[model samples]
Target chain A: MIQLIAYLIIIVLTIIFLIKMIPRKLKKSPPYTCGEPMKFEKPETVFYRTLSNILGLKKLQKLSTGNLNDYLLMIFICFMLLLIVLVMV
Target chain B: MLAPYAVPLLICTAFALPVFKNEKLIKAIAILAIFLSLSFVLSSSIEVFNSGTKVFAVSGFKAPFGIVMVLDKFSSTVASLILFLSLMIAAFSSKLVKERVKEFYTLLLLGIVGSLGIVITGDIFNMFVFTEIMNIATYALIGFTAKKEGLEASFKYLIIGSVSAVLMLLAISLLYSHVGTLNMADIISRIDTNDIYLKTIFIMLILSFCVKIAVFPFYVWKPDVISGSLEPVAAFFIGVMTTTTVYVIIRIFYTILGIYYSTWFSIIAIVTMIVGSFLALLQKDIKRILAYGSISQLGYIFLAFSTGLAFQGMYHLVNNAIIEVLLFLSIGTMLMHKKMMEKISMYAFLLGALSLIGIPPLSAFFSKFFIITGLLEKNLFIYAIISGLISIVTLLYYMKIYFMLKQGEKKIYWPIIILIIAVLLLSFVPVWLQIFKGVEVDLLARNEYVSEVLRP
Candidate 1:
């Protein structure tokens, strides 16, 4: 329905605004203790850093580091998505 | 009809300020803009009182046809309280934002604008829009600290907030599909109480609001979000923003849906009170303690609403806002703004703490009395008794906060002193101007709200 799609559009726009507009440039930080940190010690590839900056994907920095809380977030989102799919179907 | 520029004036000022980019001027502008907003709100509230409900029908469309902003007493009262607390926050926090001054005030104003919109709008979709605006602004502000804990807390809020938003949209879609209207009054007029989807929509809407207010089983974000942010921001979150959500939920039940599902609501309220009290007792941090206490106060307000004493519930709402604002503002100053903090006297600190704990001769106690009285009047003796026991637990934790401060040298300042005087006078002055009496009773003026918004 148009109403359903309209709702999704509004929520998606909000998500984009959250990711792209807010959360200022990530400052320099110590490298991860684990091995996932890309060896950009010489500071190559501005595009990757830009991607990291805009999306705040701490993929490399947060490698092998985690919290129970993050796991809980995972579970919550999964459960909610399941419910939404069920209702929609 | 008062023009609806009051909300937009704030939004326009916020968006226009980035070019100037001066910190002092930004603070001045935020404060002045909030002050003007408050002036318009109070004056407009007077007009609403004299006339009927004030409707700002956008684009020359009326009622069910357009984005309508309706200011009844209930909405205006909450809106004005939000603006009042916002002004205090702006003035209190001006000296605090050394970095990101413009962004801070801009987000703060935008958040206020959202809250005002939430309180005023008659359309469910507009309510969703306002709620998201408030939540997003809150997300960015919570992230302002840039510390991992702050961001983590903010992200937690984002996830949960996003879930609530989706639920809100789904609920609105359900309502629209059922009745083909987004206007709250129109939906109410067309609501088929016997239909099963009505119950589903009700539950969904209640769930969405519960997440925002951090009710039981969904309050995981409250402790982190309240403790991680700066103290006044925490105060604003717990005091004003939570009040807005609860107010909307309460209004939905009272004004629109007409209490077909009140028993379910009562269950939620009772559980939130007891759980929130018990959790507050477990917390060591003052912010976390206040956060949990905020939940407990919300439970009391909910209890009042379930008993069909929305007026009493609103009294407690306004009263709780004052108590939380005083507690958090003083505690925040003590923790963060020590340099600018003037030493608060025991009279002020003890009054705020005792008021929160619901001691006699304070407005907080009186509001609780009204709620308890309402519960008892409805013959919900069990609920009244349990609520009483929770009050004891509440006093225990609030006293814990009081004793925690005793070990340190205490500090109270002019703002707190003024608040202390205001609290005492608000309760002590027993004339017609009793702050609780006017709005407490009128919050149940359903006919006025229904007629003004629907058939105006």
Candidate 2:
């Protein structure tokens, strides 16, 4: 039981560290498009606009995702959970 | 007495890197180190074959308290293959790796040492440490090019590999907690007494090994990383790395856990075989296709072992390693041609593809036949049919690659002819099965592995 708690704490701390390391200024960038700039966009609404653009919910949006480390991490977490269940069973 | 040769040779080669001013001297050192290691492997294999088993207690400490190196038929055979393939890859690396030549050889030798340690050591903690060393060296080797794709692939591998390592460590901890001994033989002696905790630890260990073997769902990183690395490095990684891991898995399952619970294992093996083959048939990139083919082949080996066919599994492992090395060597040679990308050599590709698909008279066919026979002996008729169907799918995928390559018109190189002959000679050699026959032939009834290891 104590070991399980320790594992949970480590996981939480790692996730917190990842989130805190994100750059605030970079997160506030204007909405990005593939070829053209937005002319009738509200500057105050840039965060949502950029989020939509990155998620491909906006016109001419190019979702340029970089590495796949995050996805691998998620799959690894899933496997670990599966292992824990298999052991506990 | 000669057991320390592996570490010292690696250290000497690493230290003498700066003194060698000429490229020829560096190449000579690389070849010398590998040749000496190969000789050690050969001598040790012969000793094991004659005397049955030889154990080296490091610094003269007793079992369960100190590190032990056991040279049995199983370890010696796998070790010999590792050394021989490393020699061939080192020769190939001389021409292949121009950038960071010294560092390449250093890491390559270190990786070889780690793998050898994993094969020979009887202590579980030492196995974990050796596995880490091997993983770190291989991760660096994969990212040696430092290109964007290489870095990305390495990062992906690093993340997945770390999780696997953690799982393995956790499994070790569980075992230690239960058995109170890290020695494999000691653990085996105590395994039958424990009930619930033993099953928990067993499941954990199997899960960790599944990650290492990349069975079915745990295999996503292999294709990406293998395709992204350089040709010779890719060849070495496939030829040696995966085989050693699978060998260790076999050791753990058969020698440590015993085969009383083989029914559970058989189910897992069948799933991995079917799924891996289906995925292999859908791949497009040549290297990715080969990577998937290797996973499927490993599945067949697992199936053979789960049905209490240790000799057949070992034979399949040896044959698969030889075929993969020859195939990758041919691919590496073809990749060196100036116009290779413009018009890929059809003959070279066809030979590689045919060898992978278990074509008649090839090394793969013999191993595949052994596995099918084992399955039939166990009365696994449905699995036998599934295995046959997947074998056809494997042939179809490989034939597609061959036909696509053969569609182009280009003069075949001399190296391709050499590779063809090497593959043919390997297929003709009955050395592995002969060794199996010489030893206790019926591995199904009672495994001779532990007895062989403790013989001396």
Candidate 3:
């Protein structure tokens, strides 16, 4: 237990030392493509767009069009399907 | 005895709010009323733990013949949780809700009354009535801002909720026709699961509740609804409204129908989880993302229930509710004071997001761990894997929000601070708490529940 405690203290001290002593550089620069600065799409937007495309989420979102008629239609379809499935079961 | 007082107390307070012109006085009265109701709920829960189920037959009429409020271990525990969360929301909303103070408090108290009524009632018809009251209050609350988007979301939810309510009422009528009683226990005793009519009734009821709890295909309204509402109201929806609906679904399936697992339901749960996670990934707005995350979490709870992991499901439900409330209320605070976002609020938000992602030593992590382990025990390795993968996706969206709000000043928001502390303390629940003791057994002990409710 003593050894474990000593190890934990050492780890804590190392973290504190690293945080306090590290020379930090904070600056903003445009992305470099070859020798020129290039405009880049935000990574978050790119990631989400890629994910949405790969998952066919646009199709799903289209189905959830926030239309009252569409929602009612979906519920009706679900209800009918449930009835059919349960009757078969 | 105290169990029955929550609904009446809140209802009376709601009506009394309109009489007071002083906004501070109205807020004080509303908070005091909910505080009193919460105290009563806790006291009643203690009584239930010390003894057993307490059944109050309304107006001296016996069960099956009149309205009854059955306060059992399950009901009392859920009711206490609901009131506790409501109290938190009420306190937070004191500053959050600015316009139409009387209307807001009145509607909020009425909504609480409806929620408590749903939790405690023994009659299925009465449950339906309470649900309507809750839904109506929610519709007005969702559109309280009177913005275009808010009104649109409210109108949409109104249409869906009305249709689902009709389906539920139809199911109840069919059930009454077949069993000749509206009392849940009585219906359980007479229910013939093998019969086609009975099966139809069960499906209708489940489908309606599926919509109410925002399961997939029926869940599209939830994100829009949450995004449209004021943040505190959104917190109420995520924390109390959905949680109570989940309780109602569990009560009906576990207690009334005595059906523990269903393949179709599990399929729907899996779909709901996948859909919610993917949709959440595509969202830029914090509220919409959390809303979709909530839908995904509901899928987890439903999947656990589908596999007969009652304790794990309930644990996840409670943890998810806490984390969502923390996140929403924190975001709400930031929105309320946009120029003065606080470090404590940001830390609280991050903690909630991490917990929702099932990070180590957090309350949600344990619940997710139990759920995964429970699934493994049931030999559902694929479902367990799916749940874990979705947790990663949950992390992705919440991290997106984290990056957006990485900077804030050092200050304290009391409600978020309290919730953060609560989230930390809940991590100890698995090891030290007996709060959920016998709850799982009680859920499965339909025979005991029925006998007690039907006893002479």
For each prediction, how big is the interface RMSD? Answer: 18.8, 19.3, 8.5
Q: What is the lDDT of residue B407 in candidate 2?
A: 39
Q: Score residue B204 of candidate 3 by CA lDDT.
A: 85
Report the error of model 1 at residue B401, Å: 2.0
Question: What's model 1's lDDT at B241?
Answer: 92
Alpha-carbon lDDT of model 3: 0.83
Choose 1 or 3, whichever is better by DockQ.
3
Q: What value of lDDT does candidate 1 attain over all alpha carbons?
A: 0.72
Docking quality (DockQ) for each candidate: 0.01, 0.08, 0.27
Per-residue accuracy of model 3 over B1-456 as CA lDDT, tens digit each? 777977888898999889998899999999999999999989988898888889998889999899999998888888988888888889988987777999999999988999999999999899999999998999898899899988988898898899899999998898888889999889888875589878888788878888888887688678888888888899998899898899989998899888898887888899999999888877777789889988999999999998888888888888888888888888887767774456788888889887877766789878887788777778787887788778777777777776566456676667777888889988997452356656777888888988998898
- Candidate 2's residue-wise lDDT over A1-89, tens digit each? 43235334433543453344333443344565786654543332443345345644322111112336544654566467756765554
C-alpha displacement of B378 in model 1, angstroms? 1.9
lDDT of 1 by residue, B13-40 (tens): 9998787866788888888999998999
Encode model 2's per-residue lDDT on B1-456: one tens digit a residue.
Answer: 465467567667767776777777888887888788788878878877787667787887867677788776677778888877777777866876776787888788778888878887888989999889888888888888899868877777787788788888998998898789998777766777648778777777777767766775566677788888877778778788888888777777767876533765577678777666655545557777777778788888888777877777777777777667766765665555642421333555566566555555676666666666666767777776677667755765564344333233354444345545656765764676678655324233223544543344
Report the lDDT of model 2 for residue A76.
67
Give the better candidate number (1 or 3) by lDDT: 3
Model 3, residue B343: what's the lDDT?
A: 76
C-alpha lDDT score of every prediction, in listed order:
0.72, 0.68, 0.83
